[model samples]
Target chain A: MIDHLPYGVFRTPGREPRCAARFGDHLIDLYAAESAGAVEAGGTLRARSLNDLMSAGPDVWSSVRRQLLNRPPLDHLVPLSEVELLLPFEVADYVDFYSSEHHAGNVGQIFRPGQPPLLPNWKQLPIGYHGRAGTVVVSGTPVVRPGGLLGAGVVGPSQRLDIEAEIGFVVGIDSTLGRPVPIEEFHRAVFGVVVVNDWSARDIQAFEYQPLGPFLGKSFATSVSAWVTPLEALASAWTPAPPQDPPVVPHLNDDPHHGLDLRLTVTWNGVEVSHPPFASMYWTPAQQLAHMTSNGATLRTGDLFASGTVSGPQRGEVGSFLELTWGGTEPVELGAESRTFLLDGDTVVISATAPGADGGTIRLGEVSGTVLPAVI
Target chain B: MIDHLPYGVFRTPGREPRCAARFGDHLIDLYAAESAGAVEAGGTLRARSLNDLMSAGPDVWSSVRRQLLNRPPLDHLVPLSEVELLLPFEVADYVDFYSSEHHAGNVGQIFRPGQPPLLPNWKQLPIGYHGRAGTVVVSGTPVVRPGGLLGAGVVGPSQRLDIEAEIGFVVGIDSTLGRPVPIEEFHRAVFGVVVVNDWSARDIQAFEYQPLGPFLGKSFATSVSAWVTPLEALASAWTPAPPQDPPVVPHLNDDPHHGLDLRLTVTWNGVEVSHPPFASMYWTPAQQLAHMTSNGATLRTGDLFASGTVSGPQRGEVGSFLELTWGGTEPVELGAESRTFLLDGDTVVISATAPGADGGTIRLGEVSGTVLPAVI
Candidate 1:
C-alpha cells in the first residue's frame, strides 16, 4: 500500500467530498494536508474532484507524492470505513477500445458466423468508440438491468446482461485540438489507471449495432474503481507488448516494452472465475493513445480510455461471459449453481495487481457491481 | 427577436465570460439584468456557461423569460460586435442520432451497394451513438483538417472532408441513474436547440468503421451555434414527423406533431447549395430522447443530442456533400469553383428558421466554420 498510493475522493459524514490518498488502513486527507502545509498542490487538493489536481501537471504530482512519502501527516489520517468513496474524477470523454485480439476474435466469430474472425483494420489500428461519460459510476454502484428493444417490437428487460472486465487509463493533461499525441508522450498525457466493468446488454446490442455502434446496450452503466493508481507507481511492471504481424503506421510506432504486466481476476458470487493476463494485449496503451489522437481529437483532463476486454487464448482466460459461455450455449458454474447470463442480484468483482518496485505486489483498486432488477 | 431571446456566453475585451441573451444586433447582459433585479435566475446568470441556468429547470427558465420580455433592460444592452461569443454550455455527453431517412438511404446506397438502404431496425428505433463532447466548439471556430489512416499503413490528411448540417437538442434537467425518462417528459428533460456542423473525414470513416463505429473520422471537431433557442420559443413550429413504416415500441411511441418545422439552408463559400426541410425527418427529437434513455441511461445537465443530418427527399436537399456528390463522384458548383469535398479555405454556414408564434419568421442562430490546412 505504501508503494501504491492511489488517489480517491471521499467524504466523512455531513462533510463535502474532498481528495484523499490511500495509506495502509487509513486515508490521508489531502485538503487537510495542504492546509497544514504538509503538501503543496496550489489549492487543487481542496477540489471536490481530481480533475484540478490532475490538470496541475506532472511536476506538481511528483512534488506532492514526494512530500507525502517523506513526511507523513499522521493527524489528517482517517479510517477508511469512516468515509464514503465517490467517483475520483469527472470523466470528460469516455472511450472503449477493443484491443485484445482474443476478445475481438471471439466476438466476431459469435456475432458474424462464417465471416472472418478479425476485421481488416484490426491489426492496422486500435479500434475504439466513444461511450456515455455521465453514467460512469464508482465501484459498488448497483447496476439495474436495463430495458431495451430485444428484437423488433419486443420491448423488455435485457435478457443477455453481461460484464466486461477491463483496465482504463485516465488522461490528466489537455492536448491541443487537431494535434496528435505521439506514442512517447503517453506518460505525460495520462495520469493513472483504474479497473473498469463496462456493463453490456448483448441482446439489445446485437439488434441495434449495425450502421452505428452500440448505444443503449452499453450506455446504461459503466463502473470504475474509486482509486486511481498513478503511472509512476508501476515502474517495475513494464513488460513487452505482443508483436504486430502487419506493420502499423509510423505515427503509432514506439518501444514495444510499454505494456503493464498486471494480472486481473474476475470473481462471480465470490467464486474466482478467470485470471486475465494484461501482458497478452496486442495493442499497448501508448499505441492506443497515439491512434486515438491520430485524427487530432483533443484530449481533455479526466478523459478515460479502457483497454477493452482483457482476454487470453484459453477459454478460462476470457473476460466476458458471452465468450466464456460461448454465447449462452454453455454455462459456467457459480458456487452450487450454473448460469448463462447474469441473474438479478448476481454480483461480480474484478481486481488486479502488478509487480511493485520493491519486489512485492501492488494492488490496483477493485471494481465490483451487483445486478438489480430492472425498473420496468 | 423578442420571441427568440436565445441564451449564450460572451466576453468583452477584458471582462470575464458571463451569460447573455441574443437580441436583434445586440446582446443583453443577463448577469447585469439579474443584478439589477430586472430578471431572476437565482445567481446562474453570473456563471460563465449556460449549464446552471438550464439546470434551474423550466419554471425558472420561463420566469426569467417573462421578466425579460415584460421589461426590456435598455441600459445593459451591448452591441454584438463588442463581445466575443463563447460555447454556450459545457457539453456533458453528446449523442448523434440518424433521424433523417433520406440521409441514411443515401449513405447506404453509396457505402453499401446492392443492399437495402434502411437496416432492419431502422424503422423500429432511432439509431444513435455517443460522440466526443470535449471537441464541441462554438460557432466561428476554425476547423483544422484532421489527418488519419486512409488505408493500410497509409496516413495523410483527410481527402474527403465533409460537413453534416444538424440540429441538436440540449438537456436541461438530469434524470435518475436507474430510471428512464419517458416520451411525455421530453419537454422537462430538454431545454433548447442549437445548430451543429459535425465535421467528418469520410475516407477515414470508410476504412475504420467496422464492428464499433466512427472514431477518429468524426471525433476531431463538432461546431455548434453560440445561442441556444429555447423550446418555448418554437411554439408554432410543431409539425408531424414522417410516419413509421413498422410501428415502434410503446416506449418510443409519442405525439406525431412533436417535430419542429425548421427550414435549414446550407452555404458553401457563399453559395446557397441546399435547403433541407427538417419537418421531413423520420424520427422526431422526442422519439430520440425516449430511445436514448429507455435503457436507463441517465441524462446530465449539459447533455447534447443532435439530429444526425437534416436531409430531405430531393438531391438538392441533402445535408452532407458525401450524399449530394454521391461519394465524391459528382462535384457541386461553389460560386465559380466546383468541389466534391471541402477545400482548405472552404467556409460552410448552416442557418435555420422556424415559424414564430406571432406569425413571423424566427431565426435559429447560424453555425459557421472555415477549414484550415492540416497541421502536418
Candidate 2:
C-alpha cells in the first residue's frame, strides 16, 4: 500500500477552501489538525490554496510531512467523497516538455511523414514551451470542446479533439532572476508530482502550429490532479532513464538512475487504452528544469512543467489519442464505443502508480475530465 | 502638447514600490494623491502595483484619470528621472500574437525559403501562443544573456541575441471561464497599452522551435514600458486595420477603423534602426482578443497580449533583427557600428507616438533593455 500523504485543497459545501492531507479515502484537515497541536508550522495552512505551503521550502515541507505522519487520527478526518477538491496551487507558469523519445518519434512520423522522426536538436535539449496557465483546471472539471480555425479551411468546433497523458512537476521555491538551477539540484526546486491530462485539438494544432507552436488548439483546458504526490513519497520509484544516443550538454546530464519508474495508465470512459511507462522517457525531470532555467528564466512558486505525452515503444503504450489512433486514421475499440478522436461527452482518466519501498504499489492519484459539447 | 497620464510602479532609493502616473516630466504618486483627496477610489491606491487599480475596471479608471486631470500639481509630483520604474502589474498570462503581415511574410520567406509568404491559416485566425510571464520584466531591467543547447552541438551562451519591437495590450477585467469575449467588447476587457521589447535568441529559437514553439529562445526577458497608456487616452489614434484579402469570420470581423495608428520606433545602441507602424498590422486587437477567448480560455486581470513584430512594407519598418538584418546576411548599419545581432552592453529602446486629437502627438512612452555579458 502507498504510505504517502499527498497534499490537496478540499472544501465541504458552504465552507471556504481548506488545505488537507490525503491518506486512503480520508482527508486530514491540516487547518484543524494544526489548531489541535497535531502539526505545528509557522506558515498559514488555513489558506485556501497550497501556494503559501509550497513557498515554505523543503525543510518546512519535510517537517509538515513528519508532523502529519507522527500525529494520531483526529476527529477532523473526513471521508474524501464528502468534500470537493479544487486546484491544489495557483499556477504561475505552465510549461509542457516533449521528454519521451518514443512519443516525439511517433508524432513526427505521423505529422511530417517524409521528415526525420526526431528533430536534429531533439537529443540535445529537453524541448518545451510555455502553456496557458489560466486554462489549467483541477481534475474532475468538465472540459468544454474548443472551437477555432482548423487545417481543412473550416472554422468551427474542433473535429479532432485529443488528450495527452503526462506527469507534472510542481515548483516550490522561487529561483533568483538570472541564476540557472543545476540538474543535480532539481529535487530542491520541485516539491511534488501530479498526473496531467493535456487536452488538445489536433486539427487546429496542425494548421496553426507551424513556426510558432500550439496555441488555442492546446490551450482550451489542461486538467491536473488535485493530490500532489510529494517528492519524498517517490523515493523507491527512482529508476534509470533511457541512455542518451547523441549525448546531452553537461548542464542537462544527471545520474543514470534519475528517471521515475511510474506506470501511467490512460482510460477512456473506464476502459483501459494505453499504458505509457515513465522510465522510457528520454529526458528526466532534472534535465527539463535545468533547460527551463538555463535561459535565465526565473522559476516562481506554483510553477508547473509536465512531461508531454509519455509513450513507450510498445503498441499499447501510446499516451495520446493522436498517437494511439495514428492521427485519427486507426480507430480504437472500447467495448460498445469506438473512437478515433475524442467525441462530445468523452471522459479521459489518467492514473499512475509507482513502486514502493516494500515492493507494493504506490498510488500517485489520478486526473480525469469529461468533455462538454462545443459552443459552436 | 498631448495630455495623458500613464500609470506605472516606481521606487525612490530604499523605499518600497509605489504606484505613480506619468504626465510630462513628473510622476504623480497615486498613494499620496489619494491621501490628499486628489483622487478617490474604493480600492487601495496605496498598492505598490497597479493590478488592484486595474482590476477596478473602467469606471475606476475613468474616475482616477479625471481626478488627476482636474487637480492642480502637488508636492507629490516627482521628476520621472528621480524614481526607478518597475513592472506595473503581476502578469497572469502573456500571449504574443503574430498580427503583422509584413513581419510574417519576411520571416516566412527567410525561414521556409520557397514556401508562400503567409501560411494557409494565417489569415483565418490571429496566430498566438502562451509566453513565459515570469521572465517579463519592466523596461529598465538589465537582461542577462541566456545559455542553452544549440543545433550546431555547441552548448553555451546564445550567439544571436535579438529584440522585437511591438505593441502590448494589458487586460484589466477578468472574463468568465468557458465564455468568449466578443470582438466589440475588447476595449472593456483590455485596459491599456504598452511598448514591448520581446528579447529573443535566434540561434536557440531556430534549434528548439518546432511543433511546440518558442521556449528558451524568447523566454529570457520580455521588457515592457513602465508607463501604460490607457485605452481611453488613445481615442484619436484609432484607424482602420488593413482590409483582409479573403475576409475573416463573423466573430473576427469588427469595424473597419478598429486598429490604432501608432508609429513605433526601435533604436539599437542609441541609434534608430526601424520604424514599424502599428496601423499596418493585419489583425486588430479586437480580433486577437476575440480569437484568444473563442477557444474558451478565460482572460484574467493583468493578462498581457502583444503584437508580434509590428513591421510595415517599408525597408526600415522591420520590427525584428531577423528581418532588418535579413537573417544576418544584410547587416544593419548603425553609423560606426554595423551589426546583425545584439552584443554585450547593447541597449535596445522601443518608443512610440500616436496621433492625438487637436493635431498633437500622444507620447506612448518607451521600453528599453540592456544586454549583460553571457554567463557561459
Candidate that would win on DockQ: 1
- Candidate 2 has a DockQ of 0.73
Quote the lDDT for A22 in model 1.
Answer: 94
Worst 10 residues of 1 chain A by lDDT: A249-258
Worst 10 residues of 2 chain A by lDDT: A67-76
Taking the tens digit of each residue's C-alpha lDDT, what string does model 2 give over B1-376?
Answer: 2367888998999999888888678888888877777778674578988899889998888887777777744668889889888899999999999999999999999988998998877888888988999989999899999988767568878888989999999999898777778888887888899999999999999888876889999998999999999898898999988888787888888976479999999989889888999999999998999989988889999999999889999879999998998999999788887799888899999999998868888888799999998776
Cα error of candidate 1 at position A155, Å: 0.6
Question: In model 2, which runs have C-alpha deviations exceeding 4 angstroms?
Answer: A72-75, B72-75
Expressed as tens digits, the lDDT of each residue in A75-156 for candidate 2 is 6789998999999999999999999999999999997899899987788788898899999999999999988887534688
Listed per model in order, the count of residue pairs whose N, CA or C atoms clash below 3 Å is 0, 0
lDDT of each: 0.92, 0.88
* DockQ, each predicted model: 0.89, 0.73
Under the 3 Å rule for N, CA and C atoms, how many clashes does model 1 have?
0
lDDT, residue A363, model 2: 88
